[model samples]
Target: MSEADSSTEAAPRGGIRVGAQKFGTALSNMVMPNIGAFIAWGLLTALFIESGWLTGIFSGLKDPGGWVAKIGGWGEYDGAGIVGPMITFLLPILIGYTGGRMIHGNRGAVVGAIATVGVITGSDVPMFLGAMIIGPLGGWLMKKLDGLWEGKIRPGFEMLVDNFSVGILGLLLAILGFFGVGPLVSTFTRAAGNAVDFLVNHDVLPLTSILIEPAKVLFLNNAINHGVLTPLGTAQAAETGKSILFLLETNPGPGLGILLAYTFFGTGNARASAPGAALIQFFGGIHEIYFPYVLMKPRLILAAILGGMTGIFINVLFSSGLRAPAAPGSIIAIYAQTPSDDFLGVTLSVVGATAVSLVVATFLLKIDHSEEMPDLAAATAGMEAMKGKKSSVSSMLTGPDHSRGPITDIVFACDAGMGSSAMGASVLRRKIKKAGFDDVTVVNQAISNLEDTHDLIVTHTDLTARARQSTPSAIHISVDDFMSSPRYDEIVDLLGKTNSAEGASGSPSDGADPTSDSATAAPPAGAVATAPSPTQQALAVESIVLHGTATTRDDAIDEAGRLLVECGAVEESYVASMHEREKSVATFMGNGLAIPHGTNEAKSAIRRTGLSFVRYDEPIDWKGKPAEFVVGIAGAGKDHLTLLNTIAKVFLDADEVERLRAAQTAEEVRDILTEE
Candidate 1:
């Protein structure tokens, strides 16, 4: 990695900031994976509840004798209705199960879920907060309990002891949660509910924006949105049919205003990108797009804060709220959740907040008389310093890091050609091409296939050592995300300057082929026969499972291995080899993907080259990373390499990944996988 790329390590990390960030991350992760469940409940509530939209449209659906009325959960059927049972039981259990799984995998998940039911029965209100508390606690306690007898049990009785131990411990924890943790969390929730009520009653709720807007720019939006606001908002919505809390953090007015200000008054790239960013922020509901604008000019944060406050004040004045969280905080989602009675208030809130932010941001930009905008790269670095990690979105807004030396040839390497290397190469290749850096060449190769020809190499942190061994002479960069890394832009910028400088001076290229030192190996001349395209049969509809049931990483891998085995790609023994390979090195390849395959030594178990794809509804923890897409490989030879590249091409686009995530049928997934 370049020195400039590693600068965030040298930045000061305040104790409180680190702690808050960690805690917030934990909370967000617990809830985020279960957001689909929340959304499902939200949709059900919006359509079937007593005052829901469907009833407003078809009054006959409200009659108790009708099947529609029964499904809508009216009166006598309230408990049986999808909406009530979903919010009260399904959502909380899912959150608790995900939280526990985060700590102790499947075992923790089981105990966590058992404990969550106790809390659900004990609390009168929706047990979201209670579930979050008890779920992780249950997992942690189970992990500790298991540690006591770990490796102590006799081999033959291990499974027997494991099952009974969980049963006994879960029983105790469920009782404890019901009698002890449940009421305590209820009290805390009540206190928090009262506090929010207090703020709204005093008409001082708008002041919260003073803290929220600044924190959001610091990259705490997920933490604030999914962690704190979601739980409280859900509770309030359960009682009142709608909650203002959902509108607080989600209203796009502040970001929209700031971007609009830049569109009119800002200079250079900031001005040029602002108009499109405004559309994305306001309509696309990607609030992150506008955060860079405030980050570039710190004073503009006041505009965001004022805009936030303006929106909140308007919502409060009109008693407007939403029935559910507006997930992307987009205007469309906001309106979809907004009560019909509150449309005017919600509209005015967005507009009023935007107006306030625009006026303030425009003023800040106008007062700065410098012909050129301030160095946005410096500001982005500062933002990274505050975040304690690199911000891919923020860094994309900045110019190239002047600190790194020039580079011409780069390779992205991964294990077995069945990982994110191809995807990373595709992304960086586009960036290099767009930047008009014809002299730069980027390629993807398996670490095992790498030669000492490249000047620079990139690999996942877990696999960097292998890459280094393959090409020790090259500078190696470790990246977490292959699809949307900021490194792509950095390299583009560095090469732009280097190529420009070299072209102006008519200097020789820095990218000399290292292979000139030895006689080149002759390419194989014979035509190569390969198995049918992996997508043709290897990754056919039967190999794709859109709604996978594996809750743990090992389970997910096992499922993938089983699919491969069933497809006659490999023997059953290859499944154990897959686990061994995972134990040796993380299979996580970023963009929520994991590729599990046997080690080189285990290739004897492979019968043919084939692929298996399993996409889970919730992410399974792959080491410390979360994986929603698990691809299993049983490669007999190089025939599957071409298919790997195609897989990379399919997943390289964010929109494509979202489409895959939303795919309902196995055929839909297969079609997406085979799309040109």
Candidate 2:
């Protein structure tokens, strides 16, 4: 296989399996918006049928009246049939609504109706599966309208835009039902019946079973892109009657994929798009929908093709002749559309085809081994290294590493950038002012993006992998309890060591700008200031050392919780509630730390939690049992997301894992952190 093919080879629910949600969403998107379009189509088809437009169009076009007679497959002795009605009525509306939801997140009822109307009025060309373009356009229209109203659309209207409602929604639906989808659906129902009867015929031929899937994928794409859409547009005109689609016998999608899997892999991703293709062609006769699967995983193309040829072989051998197009040999619609009672033959061919396709696709996946995907962290960490990560906690925990910046910059940054970093800036700023050294200035940026203007930068941890990309030679400091931890020590020492050297080496002639460095020129206005150590001291650092390590993670959390409760910082129920809630989803914020907290806490329980730090020797599942340490807190809600902000202050900025790996003792850790 080609390298691209090897890598692109590509969730299971239940019997539902992978791609079920995608398919279901697609179907829903197609069906819902088209409700109104269906009504319009039904109305038009009813009018045209009664008016004899089909007869005129067919006669003028030299196509047989029989084709027109079967537009909806519902012809009476003197009346036009249901086939015409269904074509005019149902498909567009149903498909449009479903399409809207799939493409657009949520929708309003009025919006959905307007979209359905647009489809009813505009659909003339085929789209995704050689079906209607109206469905997609309608969705697009609703999405556009929604964007214009954005926040203006109230919750009630937001629900109405894409959802079902009773008054206006029901009325619109009723109109569609009476005049659109009902008629077209009824007529399509007839066509489906006839198609089933035709497919039920034919003798037993084994090879036909094998050819179904590939034939469906390849030919299905060919049919929808060229065959079905040709006569409708100039873009399509060039390909008209040029392919096997003219035969009207092929399923036009990965019908062959099914057969190959059954014959080869038995159960694999090959079946992913089969269910959709079967339903579409069986009842709707729209193909090409399965192209995404093959486009996504090109390796399966040949396998699908092999299955198609095999299906044809088996069908021919069995003398199985389907009167109407059958997407999959497996679907009953194919059987229903057949002309023969050799129903047994059609059934066998379909089942065998699917089994074959499954086997083939499954085998391909096994051989490729490209299906396994990596987790997000590994992928993102590589990305982080490229982007340059800064340590937020370091600057906040200690003073900054800058000699050219002011403390307020650090403070503003704490509110908008990193609170801990800003706090450090504040400490450093006050210290500078108190010491009569009004020359040092502190700057704050995302720990992920620290600036070089500051004489010093401080952080408790080294986001070096993330920050190193942009932060070459910038001073850095490590601190304790960035949000509430001292692991950011690397930041403290590094910035401390480098700040002075960088400042001296800076050019006074670098630029006239206040923050600019010019080795031969003057420092910027309000630039230099001595950050106060007492201010850093004033910001209490509650270092909860191991105090003697615990055995497990939960026990550690329990101990931490006990300490927090003892400090009168939080209610005991908070811990239990958080644990119960966390079971549904994980709360292990990695780095061997389990930050189990909540969005809402009892007003009485909220407080500026001094600190609840516990250590563990053996990790237990904080949430997933992958735990080594945990810090629990309950900062007062009156402070507005205080606990959340506090948590963010520490963990978001520091490389806690690396720091813990280096930290040996609580006091050493504390001294290392608080000393700055």
Candidate 3:
């Protein structure tokens, strides 16, 4: 979910909270998904509009004193001839399609586009704001009309009614857009443009940061940009070929400075994650990446506010503006949008803001470290205790009733169902395969499209309410971190146990038993007596560390090896051998776990098949992947496969991973590791 969804509340804030939420969601729906389209259009406008680079190139080519004057000067190139139609026609239809899709799916998108054309034709301006207002309005009306006649229409005439209803709705909305909404929105747009112009001219524009910075932290940046600033900026840009309003919100300098401060001062994971965020925010044009960092340390917002105000002050002082909107807010995009004369001024503003923000944030961070900082181990343990309490409460309320039957399908849901959710689902799917639960199917979907048919649903805590609303019957699991949810382990364990119970009954089930084929295989003489259960061979309480802290992958492997050595499981030289095996292929697996084992030559060091488990409070990057659990295995031969399979089963389960991560004691880790 975007920051906006989390911050928005039903209660009014400054009398605009609810309206801002709805408007912001709709506007962002139109623009955020189509950033590529906006970038293409912005780049085109930057190249071909009045006083643009392409226009300059054409003018230079047609200069009378130039060498090729014999071919005649091609005076007054018509750059607008290519750009004018896009703004008037194509932009509105895109907005309309997005707005309509938000309200009523594909059919609404079609009618929304059709209605937006009317707004475009009726207004001299680009009519972007008009498209936003009317497109959703048309989709909503079409949806209501469809609902009204959905079951009332005769069966034989269903197609006829559907077609005619859509046709009539499109016709009515188009006419209404042209005659009603278009003129009214145009007047409001002009008035808003005038007000912005007055503010810019009077040098009061820098104060917008007071509102913009706070709203941005709340994830309202997209709404402010696409809804309020872009329309006004477009109007001003049309007149002067640039607008300072474009710089008001898309400046990345403030965020860059804050991230830089965090890189220097933040503790543990915050410090580790900040540098990547800075690179992505400054170069990738994703300003939203920094919102969570500020949210985590709210006091840092003062730095952002000061930085934003400083940037605006510099911009206004230098009369700097961009020829078009910078969609991603990256430095590159901002420079591309900047006019030639304003490049130096824009650069100075960004640099000045970065400098101011960095100084202020560094001071704040340093002064804010008042208390004796808690160790990463203790902090993570405390968090796990809290999570345990919440889980216990949820368990008590629901009680132990497996009547929901075995879960055949699992869905990982999020706001967009694209990024975090998709990754979470992928991790679980691989885990299921590794655990030999081939019958289970895992997929990801947007919360809005979550279906009741799903047997289990996993989503972030913030999204649990929506997930429940969509699929209340499905067992709902909410996690604070999708990347490292321990609940997946529980699901895998539950399925494994259920399969065991069914196999014991000696009755064939719909799904194949993963262990059945292997269980029935005959063993050679004395093999059965010598073979040990995975738990007995691999795990011991002494080999487990619930709060291990390793700064790197090699450190983690070494720590795990030392544990096994202390338990008389491996020779001292085995650590180096494990490092060699890792070089051959890093054992870092998904779902926050890694298995580090020695190469085949190191078998001489192994006295028995033994495993050492180390859980880090602060995760280390194990070859580019965050690893919280490192399990080191020492095996003489094929005896380690049983232990590997057991560990895979535990790690693959999301719930089990959570349990292990949140385990408060070595006993808890041992129980979770060996229970199966």
Candidate 4:
């Protein structure tokens, strides 16, 4: 099977996973990036609400006797004054900006905010859910309009058309939101609040976790907390000083219990990573940290459900509730949100739920470990191998073929540019500088804002298609793991070789030469080599394997290395070197390809700088990525760097990788490689 087919086969079937994935992505995109803002808002709500502890303390101090009275009066004023306006106006704009950015870009964000103002003005309650819906819709509509008029607009009228379109769309959306969407959503909000009130009054509130826990695991936690519970919680807090609805979804007990189970009872990296994850989940209030653990062992989701139900039951039994939403869902946030009277009840319920979940998760995990266990090293290798599959799937779907150009600038693009992509760009920048390619600029950008002027783009496999579509003329390199990809090293090697080749020919290029005494220095006479190009020397028809099989990354490397040996490219000892090199860093490049090579220490074992290509219809797991193509290299010095560059270009094109995988004969494979 091709890599794309294998990826499709690996995905969880049915509409459920698809729906869950979309919901999770949308919710996370709206909330995760603005966590700090949410925390600040929650803190303000907890401190300033009329019945809040701070507000009450300040109200008592309003009796004029001393500085305490003066300060207390000011505090009370601040709470009543600043909090209301913030929730009414600012909160919706924040939510709108995030949602709009997720769909379109900065332009979408501005329009989304404009539309959200109408929602905020039309509703008495905070229009959190309305902002979520309208923001993305506005952005999506604008994007569609932009795409439609992209090339049809007359010359010199582009900016005029773009600005007018955005303004007109924003105005229309805002009007629609006020006239239609706002009143409808306000009614829905009232109905939802009434339903929750009914459940709380009838003592059936605990049963809500039957839906909440499952949805939470599927990444709908933000939707439940901010969209449903927060509005209800605000109403209750105004009248009763608290609401059990807030605790229903924000309880950290269940996630903590699962992490605790894994920390102690789970094997390998799962156990090792669980302790840190547990700390982050409970104390840090990032419940997302434990999501992968639950996903990896889906049965563990039952633990979350039982624990959540237990916590809610205890909460309802004691009439416990929070004064505001717990923003981080951390223990600290929960405590901060709790009313004085409900503190003991909330703490008891949280602890009780934690104990229940821990017990349940421990049992489930023990059952999971009843079978054979791999050693730490082997398990770590297996984990990394599995981790790259998502990115690989992305590359397959979005063919990464972009026109080759002079690579003056490299961009690392992701859904959001501030996180992993930024780090990856920094890593590459440092590597490039170290290689003396100072003329080449490297930067990070959101996929939505990626410019065509960028000559090379590096992005996560999942974002590769978007990057390719945005900058089709730039060379694209997709990686499964951004932090530790060997592709960066490969790029540095390629640049160095290119610089040397250009220097020898006295040709100016974008990359600077490390060894050059002056910027414009020319190579001495007879510097150019007499040998055939690295491309011609590396690939041979004899070294190509049309059909190959390997269950593991190491096995795949060994198979490729054996092919090189059979083709007289390298000695038998070179296979061991290949494994040693792989042990240091994964060779899997996103887009269903892996390039395994030996360390410099094994350079003497190479008879020539040669390549062996092996195609695996049933892909071998390369770290956490599937590799349908394994290209083994036996290089002496920098002789094979040019060949590596050629291979990198071919792998960047998803269609080319598929075509190479489908080649029936060694001659076809050689022809494809030589065509580069």
Say which candidate scores most in lDDT.
1
Q: Which numbered prediction scores highest in TM-score against the true structure?
A: 1
lDDT by residue (tens digit), candidate 3, 405-487: 67677887755443345445655655565676556677766677777888888775545645655675676666654445687
Runs of candidate 3 exceeding 4 Å displacement:
1-19, 63-80, 372-676
Candidate 4, superposed: residue stretches over 4 Å from native: 1-14, 63-80, 151-159, 215-242, 259-277, 286-300, 362-461, 464-676
**What's the ranking of the predictions by lDDT, best on top?**
1, 3, 4, 2
Q: What tens digits encode model 4's per-residue C-alpha lDDT throughout 228-266?
A: 566567655544657888899889999999989988898
Q: RMSD, each candidate, Å?
A: 11.7, 22.3, 21.1, 18.5
Error of 3 at 171 (Å): 2.0
Lowest lDDT 10-residue stretch of candidate 3? 2-11
List, residue by residue over 1-676, the lDDT tens digit for candidate 2: 0000000011112232113333433443444344344334433343234234445555556545565555534345233555333443344344444554444433433334344553344333222222233334344555565446544555455557534432344355445543564445435434533443344343322233243334333232233322231112211211120112212234332444532333343234334334544455334544333343444455766655555555544555454544322333225544444433335555555555445555666677567665542222232222222222322221221233344443222211221132233333433433333333333454444433455444444542322322332343443333433333343334333334444443332333333332221111133342322332422222233435554354434345556666666666667665564443233223454455565442232324545533445556567654334566565544442121222222333343356444554577665444433332
Report the error of model 3 at residue 433, Å. Answer: 7.7
> Where in model 1 is the C-alpha error above 4 Å?
1-14, 60-64, 384-405, 408-676
lDDT of each: 0.74, 0.39, 0.69, 0.67
Off by over 4 Å in 2: 1-83, 103-132, 149-304, 313-333, 336-676
Report the C-alpha displacement of residue 617, candidate 4, in angstroms. 49
Query: Model 1, 48: alpha-carbon shift in Å?
Result: 1.2
Ranked candidates (TM-score, high to low): 1, 3, 4, 2
Model 3 gets an lDDT of: 0.69
